[model samples]
Target chain A: MSKTPIRLTVNGLPHEVAVEPRRTLADALRDDCGLTGTHLGCEHGVCGACTVLLDGEAVRACLHFAIQADGHAIRTVEGLAAPDGSLNPLQRAFWENHGLQCGFCTPGFLMLATWMLEQPGPVDEARLRHVLSSNLCRCTGYQNILTAVRTAAQELGKWREGATPA
Target chain B: MKCPPFDYHAPRSQAEALALLARHGEEGKILAGGQSLVPTMAFRLARPASLIDINRIAELDTCRAEANRLRIGALARHARFERPVVPGPTGALLARAAEHIAHAPIRTRGTFCGSLAHADPASEWCCIALALGAEMRVLREGGERLVPAADWFQAVFTTALGPDELLAEASLPILGPDWRCGFAEFNRRAGDFALAMAVTALRLDVAGHVAEARIALGGVAGTPVLAREAAASLLGAPPTPDRLRAAAALAAEGFEPTEDAQVPADYRRDLVRAMTRRALEGSLAA
Candidate 1:
């Protein structure tokens, strides 16, 4: 198959790569672009381990073809840190809350939460739990992950009024 | 797993997309949201020789409300319904049902028209289409047709859509103030397919009696099944708790559920009854 050369803006950095239509965005981000923060747990869409932001919306990177993302802005866990490499609010909250046990699903969670926190309106605990349920973490029992997000939402003033924590 | 290699064409217009579909015929597959198709491709269950990606066709990405209907274009993603695309009870019902679909990431890219075309028995949109009597606007080279919801679905993963036809849009009634809609689904996980689901739309006359009722069930059969007899029983009757329960039981008894090892026939029947009752209660609330 002939390789299709496509340009992708990843973490605000533009890069052009040649890939076949069979190549998924997750594989392309990890291989062609050499950014492996987007993990692929299930090549299919069942697992949310390959979650990333496409044009500011969280999407499963494994569900899309690289050819489909030719002109879109892609954001991964690598983009979640500050310029000086300090942890972002969400990441810092995750660390403080002990959100991860094995850390395999952490990247996808970070990217997914990044999209959630970037939303304009405040989010209640119900909305937070519902959104965070998109990705799975086998080891954490989900309490800490939920707490980490709540903590981040509080620090960023995105928590909804009168909503109590679970 | 990597998808099988295939030729890719991103058409910038519907005409271009139809032309490509016409050229490739059965060898081509239209890539809408790819939430369902891509997974099958990754599993190598479907290996089309070419992919006609219509995402770049900007005109197809719309949800327009006409005088009495809402036309959801092929590119209207599921996430669009999260905010209630239209006003009134119909939009609220769509938003409620959309929340039950797969999680945020999947919903972000999954298209409503694609789900109708894909025709998954457990798809919430399929149930909605059946219960609401939506019209599917199918397009092809040089021609187009509207397939009513009753005749659109054929079987599991199958629809009335021809190999060369593209499901361009789905038109649903705007549902006036007299109409109230309700939807209830049961699934084990947050984003798993529903085991059994029910969608209902009821219109009451000035006397506050049920004038019209459409009830549709999903996941218990190959296609979304309409509870015609059960809906007929609701005519001219007040939607009291006992009346609704009886109708729900009748709905559950009318259909033959497809049983799997995990979900037996009796359990599915029970779910149908429960979901139907809950959906009816939801309509009353609406």
Candidate 2:
């Protein structure tokens, strides 16, 4: 297979790489861009471990080709932190609320939450649970993950008022 | 898993895409959202020699209500319908059904026309398309034609689409204010493929009786099947609880469900009955 040179803007930085047409965006981000924070649990779309924001929308990185993401703004877990490497609100909530046991699925969860919170309006508890259910978390049984997201949502003023917390 | 080696072509215009599809013929596959196609490719279930990516074609990314129908272009993503995109009962029905599709990430990139083109038996959009009598616009290299929903779906993972054709747009009838729609599906978990599902659309007469009813079932057959007998049973009558149950029973008894290791034939029949009743009841509540 011949390599197709494509430009990917990751975390507001432009990086040009030549990848084969068969290469997925997940692989290109991890191998070529050397950003391995975005994990790949299942190459299939069932697992949300490879979730990323493509042009400000959440999509499974494994399900999209590297060439398909060409010229699009790609955001990964590595882009969630400040320049001084301080934990963002969502990441801090995970830490304070014990969101992860093994931490393998944390990055995907963080990226997914980032996209949800960026949307307009407050997040209702039911709707938040529904959206967060898109990704699977095996270690913590998902209770703590839900708490972490709610905690972060409250801090960011994105949580709906009067919505009872679980 | 990695996709099988294939040449990629991103056509900037619909005409260019049609030309590429014509040239590659059977060896070419259209890539819209790639949510389903890319996964199957990664698993090596489908190894097309060429990929005709239509995402770059700006003309195809449209979803608009024109007069009596909602014109959904091939590039209309599923997430676009999370909220009612149009006014009336049709938009509400679409919003309700779209919420059941996969999840947020999958919906963000998956295209509605692509879902119809995939023709999965359990797809929510397929059931809605069949129930709403959608018209699919197919474009070949130099010609085009409209295919009604009845003639569109042939079998599971198959459709009326030809190897050299592209499903350019789908037009769903914009139901009137008098119409009410209900959608119900059974899945073990959120975002899982539905085991069985039903879509119902009813237009009430002045006396609040059933003037017209349209019902479609999914996941019980190779394609979404219209419940003609069940729908006919509800004509000229008010949908009481007992009446709904009888109609649901009629629907369940009419279908010869395909069995699987996980879902038995009788179990699917039960699901059909339950989903049909629930869908009908939901419409009445609206």
Number of the top lDDT candidate: 2
Provide all candidates' interface root-mean-square deviations. Answer: 0.7, 0.7
> What digit string (tens of lDDT, one per residue) describes model 1 on residues B102-129?
9999999999999999999999999999
- TM-score of candidate 2 versus the correct structure, residues matched by position: 0.98
For model 1, the stretches where C-alpha displacement exceeds 4 angstroms are A161-166
TM-score, candidate 1, is 0.98
Q: Evaluate model 1: give its lDDT.
A: 0.93
Q: Give the Å shift of residue A134 in candidate 1.
A: 0.9
What are the candidates' individual DockQ scores? 0.90, 0.91
Judging by DockQ against the true structure, name the best candidate: 2
Model 2 chain B: weakest 10-residue lDDT segment is B235-244
At residue A58, give the lDDT of candidate 1. Answer: 93
lDDT of 2 by residue, B102-214 (tens): 99999999999999999989999999999999999999998999999999999889999999999999999999988989899999999998999999998898898999999
Cα misplacement distance, residue B175 of candidate 2 (Å): 0.5
The CAPRI-style docking tier of model 1 reads high
Residue A129, model 2: lDDT of 87
